[model samples]
Target: MAKLVERRPLKAWERLNILAFLKGMRTTLRWLLKRPITLEYPEARPYIPDNYRGTPTLVKDIYGREKCVACQLCEHICPAKAIRITPGPAPEGFSHIGRAPAIFQIDRSRCIHCGLCEEVCPEEAIVLQKEYSFSGTDRNAMMIDKEELYEAGGTLPDKYFKWGKSE
Candidate 1:
């Protein structure tokens, strides 16, 4: 058996729930009066920090020669295994006469942008640029060859190479 206790009814003001509605409206109005921070993308490019990392590239020496010795360190260290290289003797007339890569390729689709290849490169042949916008219709189009890497790296500034040592 249970007792049936009677309780008082709710007040009329409490039943309307006006406070919650007013708070919501106030928030909406406050936001409506604020200005947006968006920019016209094509006309004005967004600010990229100095330390920002975008795409990995293969750099060259000051003498306009390929810097990579084809050590395959980057290929072995890449977590995504996006890098592939074929080792060969250095090009004719090259002063270094060291081992170079006959074939160097990287699959952008498989790259995770971890920056490990650049960090581990002893010859400082690989570096990451600030280029962020790139599009490809097909998966194979995303693959980058040795020539493409050289082009993407562009010309390294004199300051980048100091005391015959690349930075």
Candidate 2:
């Protein structure tokens, strides 16, 4: 059996909700007096830390040559399967590396920015840059090819040329 509960009637002031309105106004006034923490985007990009994992890009050696030997380690390790590589014989003077990627592509839409590709690369050819803001009109626009990756990565100084004779 359910027990019957007695209900108390609201007072005149409570029915009018005057206290509730004043409480809401107090909250609004408190917030209005505080300085805003919002940042104006586009005009003011937030600071990106040194260890920020953003875009994945293929870097070049100090000599402006592609550092990737086309081992396909990045492709194999990518959890999202965003990387694709096709190996070919190394270009003319780059015979020291034996092979290079004839075709390399990264689909930004599929990439999770996990930095696994960067970590798995034996040559450190793949790097996760501090470029978090990127947009594309369509899927094809988001697909970054080998040349675009090289351009975005620019050049990272190599302490030693593993493929060349040590000075």
Q: Give RMSD to native, each candidate.
A: 4.3, 3.1
Top of the candidates by TM-score = 2
After superposing all C-alphas onto the true structure, candidate 2 shows an RMSD in angstroms of 3.1
Q: For residues 1-167, what per-residue lDDT tens digits would candidate 2 score against the true structure?
A: 99999999999999999999999999999999999767899798888998899999988887788889999999999999999999998989985688999999999999999999988888888999999888999999999999999999988765434445331
**RMSD in angstroms, candidate 1?**
4.3
Pick out the ten consecutive residues of candidate 2 with the lowest summed lDDT: 158-167
Would you give me the overall lDDT of model 2? 0.89
- The digit string of per-residue lDDT tens for model 1 on 1-167 reads 99998987868876787887889999989988888567888678889986677888998876788888899999999999999999989999875748899999998988888999988887778888888777799989999999999999976766555346643
Identify the candidate with maximal lDDT. 2
Displacement of the residue 74 alpha carbon in candidate 1, Å = 0.4
Task: Give the Cα error of residue 60 in candidate 2, in Å.
Answer: 1.4
Clashes (N, CA, C under 3 Å) per candidate: 0, 0
In angstroms, give how far residue 48 of model 2 lies from its true place.
2.0
The CA lDDT at 102 in model 1 is 94
